[model samples]
Target: MYTTRNSSSSCTQGGFNLGVMHIGAPACGMNAAVRSFVRNCIYRGDTVYGIHDGIDGLVEGNIQEMTWAEVTGWVGQGGAFLGTKRTLPEKHLDQVAARLREYKLHSLMIVGGFEAYHALLQMYEARGKYPEFCIPMVVIPSTISNNVPGSDFSLGCDTALNEITEICDRIRQSAQGTKRRVFVVETMGGYCGYLATLAGLAGGADAAYIFEEQFGIQELQLDVYHMAAKMAEGVQRGLVLRNEKANENYTTDFIFRVYSEEGKGIFSCRKNVLGHMQQGGSPSVFDRNMGTKMAAKAVTWLTDQMLAHRREDGSVFCDEASTAVLLGLQRRSYVFQPVIELKCQTDWDRRIPLNQWWLKLRPLLRILAKHEAAYHEEGITVKEVEEALD
Candidate 1:
């Protein structure tokens, strides 16, 4: 016998009823958005339910009903008031189907990322097997990596980027009075550089190291040493940005050696790599405002929007990118603009900071090249020489 947990809450507005279930990780920022939405729904006299531990809870008949007051003020909180889990009910499809049928859930607001997508797709695929498993699901991509292909940005990216920039700003200020200091500040980016690149631009770093651009350690060392030499001469301040996707210890140690050799005081902003505390802070003002707006829209979409779908693999797939994803509207379009305002066309005057820094250190590059006859002795390519100079 398998058991699952689920939550249920109901509200009525204008003689119409509404019900919702939340299923996703609390750390990913969907919880706050969903909580905000739930509160709004209750204010508007709509019903809602919290599915504890995500879809797994939905499969086991473990459910608790909730009300607006139960989830109030959660908009500012970090973790989900309704919990989450990754367990898929595919193994026990029948049990899951039976539970869904019994619960008579009206709509499920899945507050998760790719995993949630897959889970919902699977659940929908199996829905035909059970007569009782029929409900509309709206998916909210809430991953920190901000790589949900269709959505412009994941739910939590704005808040995460803001926090990263705040940290970088504080660190930059703290570096004042320190000569030749090179801090390799690391930020989270599992498989995407959106966060790192945006943070670097917003934080005004001298250089941004991201997975999108493969950076060799040897080149980084030479570059740091060159920068340190310049800083020692007169340039008192500089910033080196690092994305966590790359090797953390290796990069930090390499940059630290350059600063240590120059006798410059170096300090990195202390942070928990796992980021539990960082993830738990109150949502930023932007997030709160956006969250409120998104929640209200969600109620409208579920009630009035005719969600379109397409057939795939002999089955119908709801347009995840269009219907479910909540990329905030910008100028009447659903898009999340990058934190760093990017110019598609390059301006010589606005070259990337790394390129600008390299230009500043061109004289040093020439000085270092005088000792090595790589162009003549090794017949190195122009690209190699350019890279070496950088």
Candidate 2:
């Protein structure tokens, strides 16, 4: 982890209480957002604290003020300015809260994934005791997984997709020699398939497989056989995209065995895990501008609000946790709000063919009942569901 707290400094007007704490590592594209935020804060004459190593750092009193000069030219950089850890507030909630009170922080801005949101809930639970310490938190979704709810695109997803496509494109180039080739490209995102799905589409994969679309072994075999047949007829190459988290190991074993039996001349596959590599490169123009814009919005919201005080001194005490704000693009503007959840249900079976006959004709009664229940819960339409599952 990188520590920048020693280089941090802040300017404050006497009797004014304002500070900000950031918790989380730079594994994703959060570093760009944090640096942009510091620039915006210092430019507006606001005093903020850079707490190293997130919640644990705060509890250990590893706090320092950030200066504009220290955070400039960091908008395009990846990772975080201040170091981050997976520490939870519940571990030492009392000590962490005490540190916030000591710093007299006005608000906090947490940039990370779901773990960061859980920290925000902890801070919200500490209201009504320190009115001067009331801190408003704003979260910027920075995970490559793009699993956060309320936002269509998170900060690091574009970078991750680009990374996967670049790797696959190179692999595709190499596999174009003499024999027919098959390549399996794997991507991160333990629970979500956003990266896999989009990467597959962008990479021009012949077939895309993801946990978001659960497929059975039988169907997978058929798809491979069909692709191999296409290659045998001089197609030369094929692309198979797989989601790492969904069943990478299983899919790889099954494909290799089936391809060998089909006399495809011992077909080969490549596995590319764009892990932390997705977090470090230079930020694209879109990410840099978006980071600055979001930072400005967060600052303005914190400064303009007339929040209630819980202490006798009438100082608005801010909590030391981050809150998630959903900002979705609509038309020509960004709609910022809170989101409840993001749906992630896989319902694909290869055993049953997805032909028109199966989809338009007979439907299983049990499956239909299950579909009704899922629809009531997910707001999805019946036609959108698979015949076997509906």
Candidate 3:
């Protein structure tokens, strides 16, 4: 077992040094989160270090002290300014710990999604073997997937949704003009269907194929038949929103092929993969505001932990336990949750349930898309029952 000396005591003599890095896929508003965190730390009289190239940088000991002017006006920026990597830190724990000590960074603020959190949890669990793993940390979820557990919304989700909705709207317009085309728009979500589901609802997609809904060949056949029936009923131009990894057996091309072949007389088909575009574009107002709020809270939390480590005898104890937390927006309120509770073995197997209210939107969207008349009739039936009871 490797042991780390209590070197953080030196940070108490001067202001504590904090580190920031981005990891996992690049998402809009990451720079905004970094900017806000850097500004807040500076404002609070702390030194901020930029970990270039994420955890890989830490392993390589590539670090640079950051100043406020360097990160000014970055709230609207898209992608990560610090540069992000998909590398896991578990393989390089010793080097990462050594780099932290070399820079004397007391805490590190991670700005990314699932993979980043997993790395943080791994480090926390390894604290017994590698005492340097005891460094306090904070994670700000910034994935377009919106799949991070324990949060209603992740940073950059709104911006990505906005982009997807806009692209779908344009595609719908083109389909409408053709008057006999069904546009299939494939979106990014990996296994989480939150993006596809919500974008379909907001974009008025005729149907959505999401991971949350277990889809099969039979379901696909039925969906195609229903879409053809809708076309026969004078509905022209349909939009289908699909999660990229929704169904392993069915690909976007396969879906388009089916629609083109089966709906021959009723409609033609076109496929559009919105690939990385969803991850680009300026951060939306929601993202900007959320990033700022979350980043500031993270800085404050880290600073408080540093102060708490001060001994009454004027000596600083670097070995003092620090909280490792994730800052998230839970039900319209900001929450600082323990990272241990948020840990999961796999992204697909979420530890916390996704927003149930948002999940409810999935079925509601389906009803709005394919069963509007039945929905309206059901509403009327409920109204009639209420009147009879009255």
Candidate 2 overall lDDT versus native: 0.57
User: For model 3, how does the per-residue alpha-carbon lDDT over 1-390 read when each residue is reduced to its tens digit?
Assistant: 111122343334447788999888888888888888888778767789999998888888778999989998899889888889989888888898788767777788999988777777777877777766666787888899887776778898999999999888887776545667789889998878888888988888877887777777767777788888888898888888889888887989999888889888778889999989998678999899889878877776677666766457532234332366777777657777766766542344642244434665655676668655433423434444343333
Model 1 TM-score (2 dp):
0.67
TM-score of every candidate relative to the true structure? 0.67, 0.75, 0.88
For residues 1-390, could you state the per-residue lDDT of candidate 2 as single tens digits?
111121112323222334444444454456666676676666657666788887878889988887778876777677676877878686677787788778767666777665564565555555554342245555665666666554556676677778788888888898666476777666766646666667766776666556645667765666666666666666766776666666655665465566556634645555555566655477666666666666666655555431432246745543432232333333245555532221122112321112222222112321322223322433454564454343
Descending-lDDT candidate ranking? 3, 2, 1
**Weakest 10 consecutive residues of candidate 3 by summed lDDT:** 1-10
Instruction: Spell out the clash pairs found in candidate 3.
Output: none
The C-alpha lDDT values of all candidates are 0.52, 0.57, 0.77
Displacement of residue 165 (Cα, Å) in model 3 is 0.5
Ranking by TM-score: 3, 2, 1
Better of 1 and 2 by lDDT: 2
Which whole-number lDDT from 0 to 100 does residue 221 have in model 3? Answer: 77
RMSD of each: 11.1, 9.7, 6.3
